[model samples]
Target chain A: MFLSFCDGNGSALGWAVLITVVLGVAGCAKNYVVLLPNDDGTTGKVAVAGREGVTLLEKGREGAAIGGPAGKTFMVSDEQIAEDFGAALAASPQKPVSYLLYFKAGTDVLTPESQADLPEILAEIQRRPAPDISVIGHTDTMGDAAENARLGLVRARSTAETISQLGGSIISPDRISIESHGEKNLRVSTPDNTDEPRNRRVEVTVR
Target chain B: MLAMRLLVLAGAFSLVVNVSSAEDAVIGYVKTVDGDAVVLVAGKATQAEPGTPLQRGNVLKTGKPGSMGVTLKDNTVMSLGPDTELVVDEYLYSPSDGDLKLGASMRRGSLNYISGVIAKLKPEGVSLKTPAGNIGIRGTHFLVTVEAKD
Candidate 1:
């Protein structure tokens, strides 16, 4: 890293002082980060300066590195990053959340694991102050498109019923939204009539 | 010695009050908190509560076994998972005038981001800086994780 910054034009005193400060700062980790555009070709730039040199982050680069003219520079990509950005400022939310649940073959019943997972899902719903649940059911390719679509709705209703049972009055009719995507949106890609267990499922999003 | 420490703390407290008055503005609120979380403002760590207003330059920290969720004014939803630090640097949103920008830094842990009105209005306006590099958003949802440092 120090090699990148050494242009061979600095006095000995300047280099010594820079090295000292760099070592002092590097004793603890402080990363600097800058976000770059993703695969769509949009772009952003990140640069770092050390005691001896500066490095402009090349596109598609990511890390927590140290070394430059100042030797205190560390740069990394958004793929994996952590860094302090600035001085303290006074600051200060409710955010929505979503989840998915999957189903069994040729039936509106939730798969065994999903059935077992019901209590936790119900708990999450109850935790939210005003939860709005959106449940969508889907089926694998084992039947006609129309039948599968109807089956999807059946599955969704079944799940809603379970939620109502678990939550009692807390899970209200008005707050529950049910929809179906029977065979239309397969969790697993397969030919017609394929019994992909993964495709038979329901998605529950709570906000 | 104890009295001296208290005096120092009082000075710091007054300094924080002065700084907050100049630049703090609510841009979001904590919707949920699991385990332990705090809002670091003007170098002070205050236990974060649901509905705590988030302001510019506030660093958010979540302890082990802790997580926090927030919703920005523009509806951007962000969730931080155990052992994370995030700082909001700059944010501006004005749909009518086509003005929108968000700048933040993440130090560690995981962050789940769901784009809001600002990103939908202008994708180029949002950016997150990390030690590894910057993340440019082009999608409505993104889940990013940064492992704990030694």
Candidate 2:
């Protein structure tokens, strides 16, 4: 039985033993990573930087890299983005601030007509440093009822989104909540068929 | 009968129709409405003076970085967002295609576009130029602001 074990060519057997021992020593026992060499003459796994295993979490275009060989994780979150999205929804509800501001029929464009009083609106929003600005848009009985309602909401949200883009840090978009009245909630009611421009508007309520 | 016919023409609300729909140019949606304008108090209008009548086809035309604005004929105004550029290819007062066209580009800065009758049309007629490309209008409007890249 012992001769059978040594029956192989002595030189070949020696080399095999050496290779087996080297492989056993090189490979990790468990829960560990080992570097291996590559063929093309360039060191591959030996010089390669890699994670044995990892997991990643992504939000929007952002991602959080974690659960790898290293305990530290890579994460990216912009305070500006957080604040922008948190704009007004985070606040307690309230009434309209003023009437100087107006909303376009289907868009969030700030009209030049309000240029006379925009400074006040800016000032008001500026004062609420951390205040969440909720811009709610509404439409009267002018256009299609369903379309108007949807426009009300879209206008509100667009306004908030615009504010976030034009931010002087007045209000973050994340902290903002854009809402729509859609003729449902009216500051001035025009029950049956009244096409009053005053009924279609956008309001920036501070929290 | 002739006098009444003239009066009817004067009081008639003309329907708006799409013009040059095939043109590469497209208008953008109104982002906000101040009094009647979209964007306000940007670099471009500052040059036009405080009370300058901002017209629809008038280009903001700023040599400096982040400067642009537009005033619709209806008195609606809009400021350009950063890094954006557009041109008023065509516009129509009667809702007919090709009546009037306004286009501008925001090379860099935030843009504030306001709605007039144009946005009400809701179509490819209004397109917001963006860094990634153009944003088609679906009636919903907004002020687009982009960062100026060196």
Candidate 3:
């Protein structure tokens, strides 16, 4: 009887531990759904949220700073799951990087140096895992804001066209927004000397 | 007695005005596509169940799946893609009364939009929200797709 009692207790303890180990293995190996309280993309693994899946973005509006959604994760519902996935997949928000390239004078064409730098901008775009880009043009205190915006747009478009035709990697024109600040963001803010050569170039940024 | 009569008159007038001012609902789903103006809420077949009341669209389906060729009352065209979900959260018409507003949220997939009157009211009036961020628009046409970010 004494031996039997001891054996029974040992068996019970071993079974409990064995069950725990099995569960641990399953939890660690398989991606499963663990219901979360919030709507953010916490819908567990393989579960898709339907209702709260979409996120809206307006012009000048920044969305949630979502890092890459790698590894197993969870979401609350199908909708939230979708939204989180969309965000995870969306391109990084790139703040336009402005560079003032000074031309010799009032010329629509880009000089050799400026042309060379174009490759650098294209290279930057290629660097990101998936980079978003935009180009805003600027001019010296030489033309009207409306005309400058138009000219700047044209310049930006021409440069973008060249990049597209490079045939290395195709960048969609729609993805690139080209506009002119019309010297609003000047490279140099000399009170008397508003017109600077540095202000006549294009700015490129990748996110 | 005279004062009570005047109060009742004012109350009646207020009630009548309130009844007149209730806003109506205008909502629809993509019915079919016909080039520019996509159909919304298929009037298909012999259902003859009238149709979904039209509302000032915050988002419309056009030349896209789910809601292929849906048009808004404002004449704005929304082109949506397969497996994509869009919601017109809030929309208002009549600028003088108040600015006509349009708001949309995308759950998945891709979409394209062409603005009409509401956008005309405010140049930067349209807003598209994705998980990554919000897209602010002012007087231009654009398209967007949802993809995994690295």
Local error of candidate 3 at B6, Å?
A: 46
Per-prediction TM-score to the true structure, in the order listed: 0.41, 0.30, 0.34
Residue-by-residue lDDT tens digits, candidate 1, B9-121: 99999999987764575677676777788998889999987657678888999887777887776667787877789997988865535668888888786676666667767
lDDT of 2 by residue, A1-207 (tens): 111112223545566466547765222111111111112232211011114533221122121111123222222234522322222112111222443356555455656674355566667666542344456677777667788778788777776665666556666555565566677667787874567667767877543
lDDT of 1 at A103: 71
- List runs of model 3 lying over 4 Å from the truth: A1-102, A111-113, A126-133, A143-147, A167-169, A172-176, A190-193, B1-150
Docking category for candidate 3? incorrect
- Rank by DockQ, highest first: 1, 3, 2
CAPRI docking class of candidate 2: incorrect
Order the candidates by lDDT, highest first.
1, 3, 2
Residue lDDT tens for model 1, A1-207: 332222222444466457647875343333332333433564434344333554444444332232323323233333233332111101112344555677768898776788888888788877865455667888899979999989999999999988998889776776676788788877779999998888888888665
Candidate 2 lDDT over residue span B1-150, tens digit each:
999998777656232122223332212222212222222323243342322333334444333333334334322345542233344534544332334333444444444343444554534455545342343333322333333445
Chain A only: TM-score of every candidate?
Answer: 0.56, 0.46, 0.48
lDDT for B56 in candidate 1 is 86
* DockQ head-to-head 1 vs 3, winner: 1
Off by over 4 Å in 2: A1-100, A104-109, B1-150
| lDDT by residue (tens digit), candidate 3, B20-61 | 453244433232332222222333222111122334333333
Residue B83 alpha-carbon offset, candidate 2, angstroms: 53
